[model samples]
Target: MTLDFSVVTDVWQSLVYGTLGTLFLAVAGMIIATIIGVLGVAILRTHMVIPSFLVTAFVEVIRNTPFLVQIYFIFFALPLAGVRLNPTMTAVLALGLNGGAYAIEIIRGGVESIPKGQTEAGLALGLHNHEVFRMIVLKPALRAIYPSLSSQFILLTLTTAICTSISAYELTSVGQRIEAETFRSFETYFTLTGIYLVISMVTMWTLAAIGRRAFNYPQR
Candidate 1:
C-alpha cells in the first residue's frame, strides 16, 4: 500500500484545534501547579506539624500513583461525590495536582541547597519571614531549579496526551478521530508524533528564554 500525505490536508483544521486545546490544558495546568508547589513548600517549611504532615502525605500519594489513575479519579470519581467538572477542567486539575506534587520536591531541594546564612541575613535586614521567603528564598531557589522545573513542565505538556483518554479533545484524540474517519491510522499518528515533538521543542525554547529574563544574575 502506498503512503499518502494528502490525508492530513483534509483534517488540518481539526489538528490545529486539537493542538491549541493541548496548549491550553498544559498552560493552565502549569499555572496551577506552580501555585501549589509554592504553597506546599511553604507548608512544609513551617513549624506546624499537622500541615507539614498533610502536605507530605499529599506529595507522597500523588508522586507515587500513576497519573492515569489520578486523572480518572478526578474525571469520574468526583461527580459521584456531587462535584462535577468538564473534561478540560478535570484534565487541568489532574495534571496540576500531579505536577505540583513533583514540583514540591524540586522546589524543596532548591530551597534546602541555600546556605543558612542567607535566611538569617534576610531576617536581620528587617525582612518578615514571608517577605524574606518571597524576595530572597523563592526567587533564588526557583532560579536554581528553573531547569528542573522547566523540564517538569515539558513533561506535563507531554502528559496532556493522556487527557485524550478522558475525551478532552486534545491532539491525540483529534488524531484518533481523523484516523477513524480517513482510514489513515499510520499517517495520522505519524503526523501527530511530529506535532508533539515540535510542541516540546518550542516549549523548551520558550522556557529557556523566560529563565534567562527572570533569573538574570551575574555568574561567579
Candidate 2:
C-alpha cells in the first residue's frame, strides 16, 4: 500500500478530540491527586483522628497495588455497594488515588528535609504553626520534590490509556477505534505512540519551566 499523507489529514480531527479527552482525564486526576496528597500528608503528619489511620492504610494499599486493580475495584465493586461511578470518573479516581499515594512520599520527604532549625526559627519569629508550615516549609519542600511530582503526573497522563478497558475512550481508546474502522492497526498505534511521546515531552518541559520559575528564589 502506498503511504498516504491523506490519512493523516483524515484522522487529525479525531486525534485532536481524543487528546482533549486524555487531557481531561489527566488534568482532572492531577487536581484530585494534589488535594489527596496535601491532605493525606497533613493527616499523616498531624495524626488528627481515626481518619488518619484510614488515610495511612489507604495510601499503603493504593501504593502497593496496581492501578489497574484499583480501577477495577472502583468500577466493579462500587456498583455492588450501590455507588456507581461513570467510567471517566472511575478512571480519574483510580489514577488520582494511585498518584496521590506516591505523591505523599515525595511530599513527605520534601517536608522532612527541612532542617529542624528552620522550623524552630519560624517559631522564634512568632509565626503560628500553620503559617510557618505555609510560608517557610511548603515552598522549599515542593522545590525539593517538584521533579518527582512532575514525573508522576506525566506518567499518570500516559496511563490514561488503561481507561479504555472500561470504555473511557481517551486517546488510546480512540486510536483503537480508528484502527478497527480503518484496519490500520500498525499505523494507528505507531501514530499514537508518536502522539504520546510528543505530549509527554511537552508536559515534562512545561513542568520543568514552571518549577524553575516558582522555585528560583535564593536559598539561605
> What shift in Å separates residue 7 of candidate 1 from its native position after superposition?
1.5
Model 1 / residue 165 / CA error / Å: 1.1
Alpha-carbon runs more than 4 Å astray in model 2? 1-8
Please name the candidate that would achieve the greatest lDDT relative to the true structure. Answer: 1
Question: Residue-wise lDDT of candidate 1 within 90-183, one digit each (tens)?
Answer: 9999999999999999999999888889899999999999998898888889999999999999999999999988999799999988888889
Supply the global lDDT for candidate 1. Answer: 0.93
Q: Please list the residue runs of candidate 1 whose C-alpha ends up more than 4 Å from where it truly belongs after superposition.
A: none
Compared with the true structure, what per-residue lDDT tens digits does model 2 show for residues 1-220? 7554455558899899999999889988888988888877777767677878898888889888888888998999989999899998898888888888888888988999999899899999999988888788878899889999999999999989999999986999889888788777667887899999988998899889989999898986
Which window of 10 residues has the lowest lDDT sum in candidate 2?
A: 1-10
Candidate 2 accuracy as TM-score: 0.93
